[model samples]
Target: MGGLRNLSGLDASQLVIDGDLKISGNNNLESIADLNGVVITGTCMIANNPLCVGCTCGSIGLAAFTTSTTTTSTTSTTTVTTTTSTSTTSTTTRNPAYEGDVLCQSSAQLADAAALLEDRLRINGMVAFSNYDSFTCDVDATTLASMTAISHVEALEIRGSTALETLAGLEALAAVEFDVAIRGNAALSNLSGLDTLSSIGLDLTIRGNALLTSLSGLSSLTHVGGQLAIQSNPVLETLDFMTSLGSVDFLLISNNPLLTEVDALASLTSVNTLYVFGNDELANVNALRNVTIVGDCFISGLKDCVSPDACSCSDL
Candidate 1:
């Protein structure tokens, strides 16, 4: 059998492969720029090709290859190319379930990130802010506009944005297919930008945002497919923002020194597991008056919180 030196047959705009692609040890190959439109329904593997350069293998969108993959080049200096041109890219082919996580370290890379997010209707992996933790520049309207334009994402995490005062840029964000965790932003004051977010397909955790005093922006959220947690904000006064929320498997609210009430979560009716602790000002759980079922309950550390009759269920 002649080793494949040219992939002329696979160089079509609508190429489709029903099974895995395992191409390796080719000494004559040069570039995979021609296999741009190829779609493999299974896994892909390309390794030990001495002359092969660039991220042609990864240029094929990970969504096309639905299974695990690996790519090893001869020079050992791996670079990723994108289907659509973008300054930021990630090398993927390891796990089938995820295409790759995109990291945007600066505002200059926001365009690349927007391009990546705009490549498809949904992203199978993560889009993160790497340099936000210590960013000195403002997370401007243009940056937030790009981030908010993304309607479907697997996971969205923002950490340590010291100067961010609000989620004003993320106003258009409506859905997170998986988790949304916001932590360590010292200047963030409210959930004002996520005003349109109505659903989270998985967990939602808000922690360590020191200046955050309200959840007023999450007023539209009505469903959570997994857990809901709010913790460690010293001045947060209410859970009134999530008034529309009704379903969650687990609930956790803890460590807020000024949070005196949870009356905002009055709409929640189901929780399989719940833990409420560490808020010194919280006096009662009158908000859980509609909660009729709980599998396990852990409530302690709130000096004035009296056990309400609504949580008097058989399981806990």
Candidate 2:
């Protein structure tokens, strides 16, 4: 349309401005606010004062908006989930809900969502933070610190954040039922600071931590209301803290070589399937000998199942 400014101040619903609004002749056309949703065409090069909401300028070169309601939370803890080594296809899985009171979104289109978060999260509907779970960003542990501007979210899936190296800003999340998946972040080192994350009453996944040497810091991760699967963490040598666990159904930990001595596993008598595979260093399958193996006992890599007085792996 020739006149892009025709819809200005128009209460017309679903008004869409296709092209960039420019004052061709007026040199004194001070910056203006749309006071309504406006879509821009092509790249827009406007000063901070000229930008408007819903301004879909091409590629967003340099634009800033300041509203008193723009909530900014500072980073308090600097923790990161471990990395993964193998190629695995992601499956569709729904986990528990909010670990705290508010859920923050990094890409707030409405611009003032934080102000309504407390209100929308009244009964059940979660305030969509960042609208992120639907897409993936190439962020790693080292860069997670820069996402401090990201607001609170009840549940988050940065699993596809290839460049994500840190799990910092998440300590502020106080929700009870949360599902966190940071699977594919290759450079993440340790889950040390995630000690605060134990408060998560539901499922938690720190899987794919290929270089993770130990799980000592996660000793606090004992009481999960649901399943806990930490598969393919090959370097996780010790599981010292898991003895405190009261219940678990599918406790899958495969391909972890250094993780020997699961005697501490007695705590999880409630688990139905205890998959311990590809663990070469595991010599004693006896720690699990006493427990009633209701399901398959995948202690295959062991040199041999301990001989119980001559039965040679008796079927008890």
Candidate with best lDDT: 1
Question: Which residue ranges in model 2 land beyond 4 Å of their true spot?
Answer: 1-136, 140-154, 160-166, 173-178, 199-203, 263-266, 285-297, 303-316
Where does candidate 1 stray beyond 4 Å? Answer: 1-100, 105-111, 114-121, 131-141, 306-316
Model 1 clashing residue pairs (backbone): 67-96, 69-93, 133-160, 283-305
Query: Compared with the true structure, what per-residue lDDT tens digits does model 2 show for residues 1-316?
Result: 2224323565423544444343232223332343233333222333222223333221121132211122233434436654433321211111111123333334332333333322121212333232245643344333344323333344545454444344564443434355655464565555544444444445556576656665444545556555566767767676665555656655566667676666566555555555656767666555444445455444456535456621112422
Of the candidates shown, which would achieve the greatest TM-score relative to the real structure? 1
- Residue 64 shift from truth in candidate 2, angstroms: 24
Cα error, candidate 1, residue 98 (Å): 12
| Cα lDDT, all candidates | 0.68, 0.44
| Model 1 RMSD, rounded to 1 decimal | 12.0
How close to the true structure is residue 258 of candidate 1, measured as C-alpha lDDT? 89
User: Model 2, residue 17: what's the lDDT?
Assistant: 40
The Cα RMSD of model 2 versus the native structure comes to 18.0
